[model samples]
Target: MTAGVLSPRARPRLGFLGVGWIGRNRLEAVARSGQAELVAVSDPAEVAARAAAEAAGGCAVLPDLDALLEAGLDGLVVATPSAAHAEQAIRALRRGVAVFCQKPLARDAAEAARVVAAAREADRLLGVDLSYRFVRGVPELRRLVQAGELGRIYAVELAFHNAYGPDKPWFYDARLSGGGCVMDLAIHLVDLALWTLGFPAVRHVESRLFAGGAPARGRSGPVEDYAAATLTLDGGAAVRLACSWKLPAGQDCVIEAAFYGTGGGAALRNVGGSFFDFTVDRFRGTARERLAGPPDAWGGRAAVGWAAALAEGARFDPAVEGVVAVHEALDRIYGA
Candidate 1:
């Protein structure tokens, strides 16, 4: 069916699975947007579920995915652990429910492909919360590069380092969280690089992983606390990525993505160690011009876009294949 804008009374009913901080945040955003009706919430934690239900205008609190599915949901919002993402999304899709899920989408490329196939078979919408693309600076930078304002793009550098590690135990488990820094943080870098460069075929990938200041012994060993990788795009552009947790960087966080071309360069960087505030600039010779900056409410844009797309009757977009491409790159990085 051709997509069109939805009215309030015609909005799709949505159920939230895993009402953690991120989940609730997205729930609130979707709830406030009036694009979807939040009809149910599911979380193993009673307190979290209750909070989410209240935020969702007293929506039903169900016990699990099955119960939520039975509540007449038209879509599912998944904020569960990384390992469970693929299975949960596939189940929802098989039952004909659209899904907006947190990133990594799956533990690996094989799992990601299954989910994509299910969505295609079911003719349902599938979205991943790669929130970085929704940021204010990203699209503008993309415009410049695509317009050739950056000339022949030669090199790109991306990094994300967090002073504190995840408080959840699952984040440290290799099997559950996928990998450490690469999966959590560098995923954004890889996505931005490939996306802005128009999804060029990645020709080669070389990587080194480390855990607790030592080289990781094996895939099944400790999850890497630090990771660095280089990707050579088919068009000959070089992309480098690095990310870490508890790096003693003397800051709360460090995040940057810089692209260099033969004519000029452009960058998006966090301001003063603040994660929420950012600045984008273009460089020409020794001079620089600002493009965009702070006070950008970007965290919830991806979720909001998904809800709006669902409202518009979008189903099984061909762009979903990008998720598999990203997972394939991650697989090569982890040597899985």
Candidate 2:
């Protein structure tokens, strides 16, 4: 389907598959866009589902994926567990429903590729919540890099450190959550670096994983709480990433992505240890220029964009290939 084919009066009917805090937040954002109609919500937690449904003005609280799909949805918003993301998204796509899923789209690159194939075969729209790319500072930095203003990018440094770990039990399970800090947090950092650099092919990756402050080895072991990896991209551009949970970093969180190029450098750093507040700056010879700052309100923009695109009859976007690239990078980092 093409954007021009949709009638202005027609709104896409969307189903929320997991209405937890993140799920409900995204649902409310899409609702506020007024481009998609919330028709059904399904979550194992009845209270969460009820809250989501109430927020959607009494949308039906369905039992599961089967019921939500049967509710005649044009798209499905998947906020389920990592292990279930691929199967759930593929099922919705096979049913001719568009999908907007939370990140780590699948456990690995192979799973992510399968989901992308399903979307292509079904001719349905597919979007993943790589939300950091929607931040105000991100686009400004991307524009500079893409416009050749940054020159030949040589090295990139990305970090995401959180003082508190996930509250969910599944996050600690290797099989269920994939990895730990790498999959949960560094995924965004990887995406931001490679994405801003225009999805450069990652030629090699080396990583060290730590669980409970001890080296984590082997594939089927406990998920790591801290991880550091270096990705060597095609053309010799290097990217370094480090992420951790509950680390005593002297702050609630620390998030930054810095790119160094031949001509200049640019970086997006969190302000006052805030996850949502960010500041972007371009550097040259010890001089800096601010490009963007806080008060951005970028948290749910990715969800809103997906909802709006679905309403416009947008179909499978080729750019989803970037998502697969990210998964491949993660697989390399995990040595999977």
Please tell me which predicted candidate would have the highest TM-score against the true structure.
2
Clashing pairs in 1: none
What residue pairs are clashing in model 2?
none
Which numbered prediction scores highest in lDDT against the true structure?
Answer: 2
Looking at candidate 1, the ten consecutive residues that score lowest on lDDT are 1-10
lDDT agreement with native, every candidate: 0.89, 0.90
Off by over 4 Å in 2: 1-9
| Candidate 1 TM-score to native | 0.96
- Give one digit per residue, the lDDT tens place, for model 1 in 153-218: 999999999999799999988789888888888888888888888888889999999999899843
CA lDDT for candidate 2: 0.90
The CA lDDT at 94 in model 1 is 85
Model 1 residue 71 CA deviation (Å) reads 1.2
State model 1's lDDT.
Answer: 0.89
Clashes of 2: 0
